[model samples]
Target: MESPDRTVHVAYDPYVIPGGRTIHGRADGLNGEWSVHLGRQTSVEIVAGLTDGLTRPRSAHAPNV
Candidate 1:
């Protein structure tokens, strides 16, 4: 994904095997934030523009760190 608060366009290439379409849209929000899961080993949450804010999500089976 590109930077936030900017317009982005995406197009899927067709004719190779199947078919697809293009999508265009814009987004406006506070800042970018993301949560990623790495298999069943761990999960990570990150707030854009800063690494100090990185963290793991709370879970019933996981102990607080």
Candidate 2:
């Protein structure tokens, strides 16, 4: 189990565009493809997906719809 203050990482395949445009699409509804154990006294619920870095559109990266 990880602490609430711990960092949570979410993996996703991003769309890419020419010239390195990057965008992070919104997380899938519910995002319930996986689960995590918070702790003995805590439970896991409503897990949201996310990207590794800022979810901004980077022309040099890829286009995320």
Candidate 3:
């Protein structure tokens, strides 16, 4: 994890919903399971110009799409 001040390991918890995916704590209105991409590029995009944002490190318990 790279921060503006420094870098550290950050943990994020994500879940799925009907409309779009969510980033647990930082963001809530994000696209849920429907837009989650498994092995391909997804429609979801993180905050622009910001290095710290939602990223798929692993499967979010399978994409509902």
Task: Give the number of the best model, judged by lDDT.
Answer: 1
The best candidate by TM-score is 1
Tens digits of per-residue lDDT, candidate 1, 1-65, equal 42343344334445433444333444437434332322222222322212222222456875644
Candidate 3 Cα outliers beyond 4 Å, as residue runs:
1-17, 26-42, 47-51, 54-65
Per-residue accuracy of model 2 over 1-65 as CA lDDT, tens digit each: 22233333332222332222122233456533333333222212323222323332366766554
lDDT of 3 by residue, 1-65 (tens): 33333232232324432323222223235633322222222233343212243343336785554
- How much lDDT does each candidate structure score? 0.35, 0.32, 0.32
How far does residue 20 in candidate 3 sit from its true spot (Å)?
Answer: 1.7
Query: What clash pairs does model 3 have?
Result: 20-31, 20-32, 21-31, 21-32
Model 3 score (lDDT)? 0.32
- In model 3, which range of ten residues has the least summed lDDT? 33-42
Q: Between the candidate structures 1 and 2, which one is better when assessed by TM-score?
A: 1
Per-prediction TM-score: 0.22, 0.15, 0.17
